[model samples]
Structure formats: C-alpha cells, structure tokens
Target: MVFHLFGLRALEVWLYSRLIRSPIFHQMVGRVHRRVEQIRHGIPPEESRTKLEGSGSLDKFVRYFKEEIQDQMKGKPRNKL
Candidate 1:
C-alpha cells in the first residue's frame, strides 16, 4: 500500500512538472493573475471580465507573486530571535 501511494505521488509530480512547462498552463495562470489584479485594484467585475484577454508570461507571474509576498511580510511585525 505504501509503495502504491508513493508511485501515485511520483506520477502526480511528473504530471505537474510537465503541466507547468506547457505554454497553455502558463497562459491560464497569467489570465487568472490578471483577473485577480483587476479585482484587487477595484475594477468592476463586469469590466474585468472583458479585460481578461491579455498575455502573461511565467516570469511575470512569479515576480508578481514574490512582490505580493514581500509586501505582506513588510506589514507584519516580526519577532527578533
């Protein structure tokens, strides 16, 4: 049973890797990211839907995610060791 579960997990990882490398996957992520940005910026959902047609590269998505994370981190108080 353990071996079977491990095999399934390995297959999932392989499939995920391939999916991320595909242009289609990146494009889909890009679209989602753009829609999220529009909503975050207070754009009306009706307008955002029409503006969802745009291109996004994996690099841009990664950078945007990183920036968001950093900004969130900056707003919280950190404990010093």
Candidate 2:
C-alpha cells in the first residue's frame, strides 16, 4: 500500500500530526517527528529522500490514490458492506 500509493511525505505527515500536538514547538520538533515516523514505519532511506522518484511525483501519487479510492467506492458501495 505504501509503495503503490500513500507515498512517504504524506505518510510521514499523517503520522506526525496524529502523534504530536505542540503548537509552540520548534521547527526541530517537526523534523524530529518526521524522522521518527519514517524510522518507526520502516520507510527506506532512499524512498523517503525525495518527493519525486522515478516517474511518480507527489501530486501524481496523491491523485492516483484518490482516484483509486473513488473507483473502489464505486465498485463496493461502502454502505452495502
């Protein structure tokens, strides 16, 4: 799931914001949270190194995942399940 969609930066940010709650924290805190998320989630160093790797840009990844989710919903009809 992480590879085909939900790319590194988005995953890292989700983990960080879900785990941390300090409005007055320093920038270093945010960086540390991101690193911690990456380590905890076992994201490869090379994979997390950039938003653009191979042919998939971050925007493209997000758009693809959104479309995939929409298609899945259309097929499964969430309330039916």
Candidate 3:
C-alpha cells in the first residue's frame, strides 16, 4: 500500500478513508497512475509484487493504545481511556 502507490515519487498525503477494491483498479483508473499504466500499455513486465516488509495500520493502532495506557498510568492529561 505504501511503497508503489505512495512512494516518494507520488503524493505524500492521501485520504486514507478512500478504499479501493483492487490495486489493478488504482493502476488502471486512478489519476496519475503513470507507473502502472505505462508498462501494460507499452510493454509486458516479467515480475509484479507488493512488498510485505513494513509496519501496518494495525501496528500503528496498537502503538497508540499502548502509549495511551502508559500515559494514563503516568497520570498524564487527567483523562482515562
């Protein structure tokens, strides 16, 4: 999700709420899908992949909840979750 769709070559910020059913759809139909479309329209590639070596959205959420718990334990902000 991060590398190809939002590598440094593409926009940094995106609307996370907009979920698509397929990477193929984004590659085919999205605005500025140059990286994906050009190859299919021009030349066939021998390899396709999405890298799985990265922290996911669930990892972020877990980190948040853990920090919130730690903050409450430390009596920070005077609010509990």
Q: How many pairs of residues collide in each model?
A: 0, 0, 0
- The stretch of ten residues in a row with the least summed lDDT in candidate 2 is 43-52
- From the highest lDDT down, the ranking of the candidates is 1, 2, 3
Q: Give per-residue CA lDDT, model 3, range 10-71, as digits (tens).
A: 44333332335557657666545654776668854435455444678568778988988888
Q: How close is candidate 3 to the true structure, as a TM-score?
A: 0.28
Question: Once model 1 is optimally superposed onto the true structure by TM-score, how far is the C-alpha of residue 38 displaced, in angstroms?
Answer: 0.8
* Candidate 3 error regions (>4 Å): 1-55, 78-81
Give candidate 2's error at residue 29 in angstroms: 26
User: What does candidate 1's lDDT look like per residue over 1-81, in tens digits?
Assistant: 999999999999999999989999898998898789878998755543344344665567688778777877899644424
Best by lDDT: 1
Clashes of 2: 0
The model with the greater lDDT, 1 or 3, is 1
Number of the top-ranking candidate, with TM-score as the measure: 1
